[model samples]
Target: MPRKPTNIIYSANEKPPAGTVLILGVQHATLALLFIVYPLVAAAEAGLSFDDTQLFITSCIIFMGIATLLECLPRPGAGMLLVQIPNMAHMPLAVQSLAAGGPALYAGMSLVAAISQLTLSRFMRALRAVFPPEVCGVAVTMLGVALADPALRRVFGISGAITPDLDLRYALVSSVTLVIIVGLAIFSRGMLRLFAVAIGAAIGWILAAYLGVAPEPNASFATLPYIDIPHLGWPGVSFFSWALIPAAIITGVLSAVDMVGTVVSMQRMDDADWRRADLDQAGRAIQANCLGDIGTAITGGFASASSSAAVGVAFATGTTAWRVGAVSGILIILAAFSPRLIGVLTIIPSPVIGAILIYAAAFLTVAGMELILSRRLSDRRIFTVGLAILTGLAVAILPGLVGLTPEWAQPILESPLSISTAVAIVLNLVFRIGIRQEASREVTTADNPFTVATEFLEYQGDLWGARRDVISMAIPVVAEGVEMLLDTGVAPGKLEVRAHFDEENFDVALLYEGEPITIPDHRPSPEDLLGDAHAVARFVGYMLSKRADRLVLGTDGTREKLTLRFEH
Candidate 1:
């Protein structure tokens, strides 16, 4: 098991105090709600009326709450602190659906997306080869990269003109917010660190309000009731359209990619020894999000996915307790009933949101690098990762390039996250061509056992995409075995070192022409170590047994076989 990170005040399984959970939950709820803009944008684009738009937003909030609560449960969820929100990836298709066939079509398509995700979940383990650590790293890094534009634009108040709309005051507010968050997280201790983001954002809000830059909730308070049950506004499943299946499927696949990336990052955050993506947990997460989408479909709302920004907030706060998610879900459901409360939360300053994104982007970028470097980078992998990043970045840097693609291809190329992930998966599969899982080499009497073993294993490790640490452990032991044979004069002329990997266990077999070497379970005594020079061979054999997770010695007809196994 991986050790818990030192900065984590509460892990995924441990429940914090009620007050702490409530505070952290509110923090996450606020972040998740920030994504409410996507559905609101879709409503505006579809030209929905005031009441219709309100119903749409309300339905989205209710389902988001439900999904979040589901995520905190073990059976339906990843059982982590995941908060679901309206996915930006689905906004385009949703707007088109609403424009074409009203809320009914949108809801119908959402069901399609839900089914797509549920189906995708079943194949996650089988698709592990396509989403290797490097590819996942690309997806995670792009998650941060995708946030860069909106974050920087908000921070600098840039409106994309010859003269940038760089407002120094707003920039200062953002800087202050970021500084407080970083300072508290790094320099402070205890409860302060746990509330770093909330404290910083609250302070930023106050500053923005004082500057008259942020709208006060008082202006909208009179327009909304304190509490009222939102109408379900189910558009009825009878309004389905077969023509929109392609768009709905596209939305589902892209949302799955987005959800996968977020879950991968969360897995990394929750476990210190995170090696590869935990597909089983990720599949559960997708299943939970899809169930939420089905509820959204029933209520005539947009599709939803796991919120990467909310994950970042949980990571920054250093408390990913599922109880926090439960509290946050309840709060969100309550907010759905209270329009007045939603009005207040919606008025959070853009600069504050930008500051939080900046903090998250920094952490995610570094975390992605850590995941990428977890394996040995052969030339093939380097190119695979590098080109995938370049292709993904191309879409971000040249947004117009997406227009050149066919209409069907545009959705995949719409964002850095989707484009880069798609390309990385393809590139990883392409580079995997020509590399065999099992290979062997003959070691000569004149050859340096260590050098031959290191070179051969390193090559095979790269080809097999084995974990660097696992291969590092196996190399020394394999070399020691070969050296023991040569030193003990057991094998003469030629010896065969065979390596096999199946993405689980890495086994190395040393085939020679003599009796199997003695592998003692315990350490050799000092008498055996110093009594004779040849006694050192027994000590070497003992060391080999200790290094390998399992060691087997046997004879195959004319040759003796010694095998060293490392569990991946």
Candidate 2:
């Protein structure tokens, strides 16, 4: 059955206040610090000269500013109608690809990837029903599982190569960082809890610096410091760069997954019902993602995702009122003019940042896993999803094992995100639709005992085992007067007629013209009725019997209508 129309309205007039912009700006800045660092470091590692690095960084900042502005601004029929930011998940893959192929090739791949995703946007709504909560939950869980090892390696300062001769000092720094993070999470309150990762990283950095475990601070800030335009280079679509296509597609898929989760979370937070229109809104959101990707690729950066931080900030500060897109734009532009700011961020010890990310990623992974398990699937479905996720993780960890297979199969086997998404999609199709479960017992007026009893009472009031409708005459008057009574703060349960009707009738019944009136076996509780009086009244109105012969006349000469009056 189609869902009933929702009366709840989400309008521009309901936006957050102006003062909330400051809070949102702080959130953007903090997440910007975390998100931008990886791209800068990646650019530096990809053999870009300092000047080139500065130029790339400046362009990236400008791109982020532009995307953020488009996302946060209240555009007319453009934008996601929500705040968006650079996606973090795409960074690792983009960076890895950049390491193999130079910046130009990386940008080229990104352009293709963005265009593919953009073209695919229209199909997203059509495909969404296929990826129900269960399927998406499994896919997201698999993504986290695949990334877990890399996150750990970063935390332990074991990037590039792992050896038996482990650095004891680095281990100590990581251990202490982990402890501080865990402690703060357990003990902190409010804003402190929210920023526990950042604070923990700061503490670890301070300690690491004191012990000389930190990287040498290159404090010479003289680098090209001006806003630079993005250099658009055509990527080589050769077999070598084509190897990067899987990663690009994975980036797009994961971005969609993340967006879906974020949208569902937002809907729950706002008490909004998901509708077909909402699905269109999501497609538009993904379409907007292509714009962010274009910006990132042109500027020699990785693709970005929606900012969960912005959502948190919006809720925490109650600042849903103003447009912070402009603020993010200005900040990014300012940062672009001073590339030295990027270098300053580079001074933070990698171990500290890695430790913070380790915890953050772990939290994200656990949450994603829980999202999968929370869906009420059968044991077989659960096992299938779990196995697929574990297989994806194994593929990520043992890439060489998969590489031993035929070269033709390498791409399909190597990309964990794609493989997992595919596996989940297939398994869900098999389990949910192909081998469907048998229908359980059906309930109807003739079959259900409760329904039969209620119908009996309606037909012959106080006859057989039927209950009387002594207060039927008063129902129409109360129903008519309810709107006025509700406006005057008269609680539905507290109303004398409501209580009387509930008492006399075995089940609640209402009568209306030309409608089938049958008492509902499971009448709502007083609390339920009073809390949502409008809904209850509307439902009662809907269920009332409209047949002229069905309505009764009271001995008092009152017109017997569906009334809330009954005898206890």
Candidate 3:
């Protein structure tokens, strides 16, 4: 098993105290509820009746709760502390569906989107190569980048028409909230850091209320029942249309891609030794997310996706226990029945939520940059990452370009997460055109043997996208092994070096017309270490054995082969 990250207070399998779990669960549920505003936006756009909108929100929350629970389980889930919420990205298409055919059309289109996600999830394992580290990095980075507009808009009170005084109050509240969260996460220890976001949000809410910046509940709040059972808002049958199918399918694919990045972020948070994404696990996560969307669809709710910003919250708060996520799921499901709880959560100051999102975005952006540099970079990879970023940014910086895309493609082209991910995957494949997984070169005493071997391995490592540590370890061990072979007269003539990488292991084989050098089972004694040429050669052989994870001595036809194998 890989090491748990030191910053993570609780891992996926570990259980926190019930009290702590409940507290954290409430925190997550509160965050997830904030996204319910998206469904409300669609409801208003479609001009639904108040009761219809209420039913839609209730059903969405219930399914999001169910999906959140599934996401905490290992079999159908990505098994991380992930929260599912209404997907704002799908809001436009959902509105079109709602306007054209009412709740039934919206539910049907959402089901199609769910099926689309399910289809993509099945092939996630096979598509690993298409989502290399840098590509995944771009997706994760854009997840953060996509949050920037909403976060800043809320922080500055620019999302709504506001007086200058109100805008300043929003800024003040958001800044204070952000500072408390960041300062606690950075400077405090133990429980303070564990509840950084919760504490910050609490303080921000209080300040907002004091300043009259927090939303005031209307007289309708007094008439709303404290608890009400949730029911399906529309009939269960799926509605389908050739015209809407493209939008639905594209929405599903984009959600799947978004889930991929979100799962990767969660994986990185839990494991200190995170190498690459566990796409198999990620596939299961996508499946879980799709299941949630399916529930929402059948219930006449909106489409849903895993929340990337919530992962940032987990990272910032230092807790990612599945127990906490499961607890949050329960609360969310219960909140669907509790109008009072929903009412209280709904009034949370937008600036406060914006501060929390800003905090998450900061962490995710930096984490994505680190992930991008985790592997050796070649010129091809540099362009793949650089150009993908530019393409994704263009969508954000130039909103008019979304209008240029066909209606079917607009859903994908409009979002930074989808556009950057598509560009990165395509560019990565395009750049791999001439790059081979295996390479070979000849080295001899006539040439600078070490330099020849070093350059060959470095180039191949970059081309094959080998782990940096693996390549770094391989270079020196191969160099020393070659010197030992020639010095000990095991291979005095020219040699052939062949390198191969399969993402899991890196193998370098040296073929020569000589006998195999003996690697001692134990470390060489002081006498042997200080002894003549042969003792020195034996000592080098022993050290080489220690360097590589496995050292193989074998023969290929008439020539003897020495191979160094490193686990990536």
Q: Which candidate wins on lDDT?
A: 3
Residue-level lDDT of model 1, residues 310-405, one tens digit each, is: 777877788888889988888888888888878877888989999999998888878787888888888889988899899888888899989988
User: What are the C-alpha RMSDs, in order, of all predicted structures?
Assistant: 2.2, 12.3, 2.1
Model 3 CA RMSD to the hidden true structure, in angstroms = 2.1
Give a tens-digit lDDT track for model 3, residues 123-173: 977898898889999999999999998998889888765465656899999
* Residue pairs clashing, model 1: none
TM-score: model 1 vs. ground truth: 0.95
**Candidate 1 lDDT:** 0.85
* Per-residue lDDT of candidate 2, residues 1-568 (tens digit): 2221232122222433444444445445544655676566677667677666655555566666666666555452133224555555656555656677676777777777677667666786677545655555655555455445655675666877788876666666777887776765566555554445556667888888887878774546565354544443333332367667776776666666666555443443343332212455556666766787787677666566665544433333322332454565566656655545655665677676556545545544554565554433455566667876877877887878886886435545666755776777777666545431111122222243334333433333321111223324333433443332233232322121212111113222222222222344455455645644454553343334231123231222221234432332
Runs of candidate 1 with Cα error greater than 4 angstroms are 158-163, 216-220, 238-243, 524-539, 554-558
In model 3, state the lDDT of residue 131: 87
Backbone N/Cα/C clashes per model: 0, 15, 0
- TM-scores for all candidates: the values are 0.95, 0.63, 0.95
Error of 3 at 64 (Å): 0.4
Give the higher-lDDT candidate: 1 or 3: 3
| Candidate 2 vs. true structure, TM-score | 0.63
